[model samples]
Target: MTAHYTSQTDTDRAATETATAPAQRDRQARGIGSIDRLAGRRILVTGGAGFIGSNFARWLAPHAHVTILDDFRSGSRDNINDIDDISVIDGDIRDAGLVANAVRDQDVVVHMAAMAGVQRTLDNPVDTLEVNVEGTRTVLEAAVEASVDRVLFTSTSEMYGDLFEPPYREDGPIAPKTNYAVAKAVNERYVKSYCEAAGIPYTILRYFNVYGPNQDGSTDGYVVPKFVRRALADDSIPVYGSGEQTRDFTYIDDALDATIRSLGPAGRNETFNVGTGYECSIRRLAEFAADVVGRGHIIHTEDPRPYRVERRCADITKARGVLGYAPRTPLPDGIAKVAAAMKRSDRQRAREV
Candidate 1:
């Protein structure tokens, strides 16, 4: 088995910090290749300022003419505020006119804008439905109107809530319990329907637990970032339920790779699961974060959320076979990078203060 944490000397750490983040370092070490086919293409990313969207936009900026349409509701300006050459549009996806304007002349549209987080969705079910489902309708309508070559719709593994299955496949039946999942489920159907009717090509990517830099622990309901932030702050890690619920965490870079590939000719009009297919329990996930920050304290509590899935693991055989998708970052390594990035963020904030 590979070691969770790599043994790096002080010199290496110093050099890495000056040059890049831990996640970037790990990605470079893996020597993963990008999908260069997008060069010279015009692309619009809904919610491109958010965690995953921002990372995807940044990665695609050099290869394509990237435009970001984000309301900054859950997205941060710090994420893409400094990235050059990408046009940033401060707008809402729900506005059909705005979405139409953004989608005009774009070769591809990656619809990622949504009201994420289970609890957040539960609190605002109507908003979730309107923004996630109806908003996707708006984007899809615009895509059809503009005659975009390809569009990728971002779905979630949560749509397969409480499946109790070891690994959820792309063809598996989805029973979404939360508003967020329900919205994503509906969005998937809407995208396919619109694309079929208008002769537009589409790809649906169902992502499992995706974690990495630019993900805000305070807002994003992901357990990994929440635990990492608390552990780094020397606060007690909170484990909802038995802490045994498992999730297949796919790294941000891997997810981006899969997303970019979906835009290519290989994955056209196909749906694939984007994940590592490895299960890591929430308890074990907390332990990793705790270990990273030298925190041993943990607090268990009943999950107050409306819907809680016991386990979630993706079956990425289709993605692997079709898109050549392979998740290289293991849980330990991904979590370690997250910790390093958070610490660096803290230091930068301190200096700014």
Candidate 2:
């Protein structure tokens, strides 16, 4: 992961050029013409250096003036180093003064900075609560003070917990079993309450297992990337318990499309489930990952967590009807993309070394 730093003046100038540049041709080529509505808008993306956040920021950068606020805790500089003309604020979201400064003059705030990962949150529950809940509160307060046009809060489908059946809906009851889910669930309520009281429009997006390029495949990363990493190495892919636990694995592009649509008027002040209405078992996913990479074998392991959701899928009827949110990528195709991206990244790293 290479790192590059530029002065604020340079960043601001580049941003101005990017905002003023015509992007219709490029947008059409990238298939992101839907987000052209955001052209010339000023947007702030907290945790814009993380996986989903960084991808969203990169997609939005070509169309809008983007500012990223991250403390570099879980987010890496490598994830965002190549993005041109992005203003980055290196600070904690819990810092009220810093958050206020970041939020000022931004047309929209996409709050994505939070302590993520199920195991990590379980190990450090207090820090997770403070960062995810309190940090969100600080961002909301700042957004209200700055009079931003909208606040988009990113929530997790894990909040649905084991109590819910498959095909979870936005209006369905949430029974969060993990501390990470609890923090996100609480933040969702905070976003709604704070935005309503302040008369600020808000959009809540509950994302399922979002995965693709730029995702972490380290010891504490998501299942898809982790599986890909091991498969590439011809190592055994671990499956917890009976491997029957299912998840709605939404690819990054589809997730981004849903997110961009949420910023428009059609998605105003509403919660939407951002996922493909399909369920894939963990065992099947592991097999697909190995097959995509052309290597590796599957191995079963004891479920470490005290509780686990057996099946989870999204009911995207609302998102589809309201925002025209349609997921175009299939699981096999998405996994192939991830494998290809990892190979390219490996080649780049080898050259760097």
Model 2 residue 94 lDDT score: 97
Q: For model 2, how does the per-residue alpha-carbon lDDT over 1-353 read when each residue is reduced to its tens digit?
A: 11112212334334423442333243233435557888999999999999989988888887899999999999999999989989999999999999999999999999999999878888898999999999999999999999899999999998898785778888889998888999999999999999999999999999999998769898788899899899999999999987988889999878988998899888789999998988888988888888767789999999888778898889999999998888876786677667767887899999999
- Model 1, residue 149: what's the lDDT? 92
TM-score of each: 0.92, 0.91
lDDT digits (tens) for residues 1-353 of candidate 1:
11233444445434534656655555433313445777888999999988999998888777789999999998888999778899999998989998999999999999999988766777887888889877998999999999999889999888898855768888878888787888888888898999999898899999888888657688446778888889878898988878887788888988887887777787889999998888877877887777655664788988876557888888899988988877886666566677778888889999999
lDDT for model 1, on a 0 to 1 scale? 0.82
C-alpha RMSD for every candidate: 3.0, 9.2
lDDT, candidate 2, residue 274? 90
Window of ten residues with lowest summed lDDT in model 1: 1-10
After superposition, candidate 1 runs with Cα above 4 Å error? 1-34
**What is residue 52's positional error in candidate 1, in angstroms?**
0.5
Error of 1 at 280 (Å): 0.8
